[model samples]
Target: MKNHSGHDMAGHNGHGGARPGGLSVSENGYTLEFDSTIFSAGAQTVTFRVTGPDGRPVTEYTPEHEKELHLIAVRRDTAGFQHVHPVMDEKGTWSTVVTLEPGDWRFFADIHPAGHDGTMTLGIDASVAGPYDPRPIPEATGIARIGEYTVALGGELLPGEASELTLTVSRNGRPVTDLQPYLGAYGHLVALRVGDLGYLHVHPEGAPGDGSTEPGPEVTFMAAAPSGGTYRFYLDFQHNDVVRTAEFTVRTTAVPRPDTAPGTAPGHTNHHHAHH
Candidate 1:
């Protein structure tokens, strides 16, 4: 690919090295454009378009995990985590509604064009119109409760290697066994490192209706940290025709590096919520 200057695109260097997504608003040939970046506190609608290599709105997309795209939004302080699916029109514009608090927020658009080589996660910053008093980071925990559900996490999150995380859900001291299918699965999980909110794309172990997959009590997924740091995990599950999210805080064990010591800060968080 070449522009008027006949230079290769920076993101398509041909090396094919695997990298994380959702860190930038534009990458390779895809861009996440929003209608407005400023919003007042409360429920509001967000409209955006994804432009591909040709600089036109991307209208053709292959659905991944039962949807054309997934939008993940969160406040800078790791509060108000939301994963929503938006509907796209013939004009290639997508829209969704989100609840906003008084703080900075990041919106990640995870999409895969019909003819594109791979999926891309483009992110843009959004500001809420109000007094900005960011929340402080909380202590790491393995247990999280949302509504009437309590989820207990099992397994480790290590840097540089795929780790299996098993989350068991129960309500009122009784294990939930009849979880409804959400997005073609029993659950959907999103992991983001605390500071930068770098997105970690995770895959569930199995989908609903699979012969070996069960609907309830436990949902398994595979996730790897980009680096050793404190991270936030949000899991969405459906039951009784309602969906709720359970948030968990966990830290990964650092991977040894030759140049850096075991306790280096390069790939770790200082616990401060940095505004991007």
Candidate 2:
């Protein structure tokens, strides 16, 4: 087993902490390691191993979310999305074989602790060692309907920076607010970078002041892309026992200079871009 230094784990600016809420990445800053040099023409098998926070082995850990671990792998550009369950071997190693195309990618291990409601996000980056033209970002398509509660998405992203996104939702041409709460939060937003589908879980900032409730015909969120690329977004909202999803396309601009506003166009406040 390879050992990783403490500083290596601290270097990730993607998430606020390497180990938030007792969840830590493996020594190499990734929960899993893969042999990227090999690939098969059609259906190929790629093997990977999972490591624990102790930098040793992760054997017999507790299960959460109805599974020991929920693993999601996606190409950085949203080309592929896979939800997989890895087999935990007795030696504290979790292994899985996935057939992948030649491209750069990322993997996320969503681990839930036993008897705890919290889930840890552990991840790593890897690629199929070969050369292939990446697929272009698919056109932004999908309609946000009242009952569906989910949207189709498209966009681009930049790493280490925050981007502001505004989503407007209406039913039959009328603004829809009074959205009820779902999953203990006002809304659930999921973002995936287009090529690798690097996942960004986002939450909306609630209304200011205590015990105040506000629904929306418009919802705004701040999201930081994990890397620079095209991305797809899915926003899920609920009302009257019905869920609705709104999808949008976004392309993250390159990081600006320190003097420039992060999410603004040259000399313009991003607030002007509001969707309401």
Going through the candidates in the order shown, the clash numbers are 0, 28
Model 2 Cα lDDT, one tens digit per residue, 186-219? 5666666554344565555454223654576656
Q: What are the per-residue Cα lDDT tens digits for candidate 1 across 68-136?
A: 999998999999998999999999999999999988999998887888767777899999988988878
Alpha-carbon lDDT of model 2: 0.51
Q: Find the candidate with the highest TM-score and give its number.
A: 1
Q: In model 1, state the lDDT of residue 256.
A: 45
The Cα error of candidate 2 at residue 130, in Å, is 22
Which residue segments of model 1 deviate by more than 4 Å?
A: 1-18, 256-276
TM-score of each: 0.85, 0.50
Once fitted onto the true fold, the runs of candidate 2 whose alpha carbons sit more than 4 angstroms away are: 1-107, 111-119, 123-136, 140-159, 207-213, 255-258, 261-276
RMSD of each: 8.2, 9.2
